[model samples]
Target: MGGLRRAALVLVLPAALLLSGCVATPQEGITNSSSPSELIPAPASGAPTTSAPLETAQTSNKAPVYWIGRSNDNAFLYREFRDVPDQDNPVTRALRVMMSQTPLDPDFFTPWQNPKKLATSISGENVITVDVSADAFNSNVDAAMAERAIQQLVYTATAAAASAGLIDSGQQVQVVILVDGHTDYVAFNHVRLGAPTSRSAGLVAPVWIIDPQEGDSVGDGSVKISGRSTAQGGKLHWEILKVDADNAKTAYLNGTTTASTNAVQPGLFTLSANLGPGRYEVRVSQVDASDSAKELFQDTRGFTVK
Candidate 1:
């Protein structure tokens, strides 16, 4: 919630409305299952056809699917990934995963209707166009909720497209929303929906924990920490904290890493930390390279080791 405070102030619903437990339409394809393995079948074509290798698609084509979650006493959108099938339209499949209402983590949720409800496509120059159903805007929510809902779609679509290589990382992908195939439409009767929206970390969780996800238990001596960031020069700082009943304390494992050598695209970093059996919190932060004190973004997740 570091860099998101101002945006939240502008977009957050009234405290009473926020506390009223306004749940958005459940994601479309999610089920009460353990892994994405249960969500959908592999592509029918059954062959690797993209520029990316088939073996990589079969095993490593994991794409991020963004959803809403809570941390640091605030509600912000976060990301998780699913193994995308190796097919002609991997980007579309990834978008389907994002549009699906099911969250990999029980703690996450989304306010947007399923992407399947809208006809989604990637056009020239990495522009994603979503033709939304008129019925998709029937939510009785406030302006803040409506705004977040649109952002939910924008972030998810662009993220999915980037993961599938349809769009470049660190580059802004434009998302155009159409209602009943018309660009001029109102969303949720509150927010206008005619312009192209771009992905911004200020609108979504800028930091994410890519491994040892919430409620996970690791037997290995060390936990691998990794995630995507939009910070300057792709530089990131991290800290490991141990949580006890009375207080949460920082552990000795703390350091910094670069997500990328240049900051043109989303930067990724991985670190390994050793810990004994305990409950711990891992925090990732984006700081100004010139002034470390000027923290731009932060995110944290809890996990257990045994």
Candidate 2:
């Protein structure tokens, strides 16, 4: 590969995990379904909450939920922060929503069924125990899709934990899944449960729309589209398409943007547009090196300009 393409790959993909340095172990008997639920160690009871109280409390109720979506003809995970009702159990509530609730993005979907019961607890070692009923595996999936589904759970669980401050984000976090308190059970008849699983590599969308999420409304007609994408040769393509009453789409604007190759937030890119009141779709894609006119990987989101 050439130097530019190589750099693009490094910026686009997540850093590889160095598991050799990790020495944490899962606590035995804590995997039982009846184990008391404790979302990691919190401040001792009756601590002062006056410092940034409103921001802290509001964040406590928000959970980062991951959903499976198609991109580049394959399945990958996408994320959205949802306001869950159960503030005390962010991880568990996020898992329940992942299995039972529909994703806010229409392009995303979940194959897991609503389990009769779901629970989560994080150990001091950063290992999350998720004990769920067997009914969650009701949906059938092939080996490949099933693996993504399991990762869908892994990503959601880990994100929730990190967001809720249940685990230190700097440390390596893993998830141990259990179906009805049993280990080594095959999930969706494909992937085996019970082992500590970390977020899998290459499961994230190469290009995604972060701001103005699907179905969002831009009240002032000033829209800002931002996302992360692999910039082949430092170039990415974006376009805004207007949707007509009959569902026909007409290209309204298009341009090329450069992705950041810096150490912080590599592949991050953003653009802005002003439009009249109407529905529109914003698309971001990486140009195919082999074919200039073709797109290698693309992501899109639909919203309204009110």
Candidate 3:
């Protein structure tokens, strides 16, 4: 994945012109705030216990896995679904993927390297605690990058725990990091690791292209582009650009689509685009109403039209 690269073009249109009367909102689940009362319930006292081989517990299940990717203006974390090995503790498995530094998308990446061992357990308070080997602190990034790295772990663990039925869906979860079982260590020599961290979609990539995944081929003339976002009022902008294979040149399609999402939680947006047989790149973005050129969140995925 290290050697993969591709070019992208972002054309920002004036918010007033593009957003006028284009508010088609969709219904979505409400995202619950992280609270002690909302934590995953621990096993009941005196429950019967059974032992199973770790090998047997390694069954495959598809769940969302997030990675860091770059847009024309910003670098943000986004998610994609992948098969993970089932286990008694799904949060640990999720964290393992985060630390693995391998993403299915070549454009995405992780800063994790060396001494990647990690252990996770949910506390009675519903706070998940992650203990990492000393080697986890090997990175030398700045403060902002360090913060994003921590959130990546938090988001992965919380999402995994929710998927495993350990926590309720849409409820936020918190995480605490301990280096070698000690909370005194600092991450990347910048941010303190002694405090508990919670999920913040604001810190993550705001837009996700869930359908027509990277390099997919669609026979239908129309393709549905869908994903989640945290933009204000759940409003997002999308455009399709036809890419020329010979020179990598791109031409804008007919018109841009505006999709709406739930404001309180991450909202789902779906839009359909009709195109002739060709190769194209679909770009979705959330532009700051105050500054059209300042893109708060954006993502692009290439697919084939057959």
lDDT winner between 1 and 3, please give it: 3
**lDDT by residue for model 1 over 184-221, one digit each (tens)?**
46677655654566653344554566676776788858
Candidate 3 local Cα displacement, residue 248, angstroms = 2.4
Local accuracy by lDDT, each model: 0.57, 0.67, 0.58
Rank list by TM-score: 2, 3, 1
- Residue pairs whose backbone atoms clash in candidate 3: none
Alpha carbon deviation, residue 212, candidate 2 (Å): 1.3
lDDT (10s digit) by residue, model 3, range 1-306: 111100101111222223233332322321112211122111111121111100112224755566778765456677766666655356666676667647766778877664656776765344667778978667777555666677667777766656555543444456767677665465676555645567754555556777877877898677777865544343456778887877384766634444443333334568887788888888776655555555445677888889
Query: Judged by lDDT, which candidate is best?
Result: 2
In model 2, what is the error at residue 196, expressed in angstroms? 0.9
TM-score to native of every candidate shown: 0.59, 0.78, 0.69
**What's the CA error at residue 146 for candidate 2, in Å?**
0.7
lDDT for position 87 in model 3 = 50
Error of 3 at 166 (Å): 1.2
Model 2 per-residue lDDT tens digits across residues 1-306: 123112211210111122233333444332321121212111111121111000111244666778988876677778777777843366787898899899998889999999998877777677777889999999878766777788788888888766666666767777778678766667777666666787754566666677878888887556788876534225678999999999799999999887666545566678989889999988887765455687655788888888
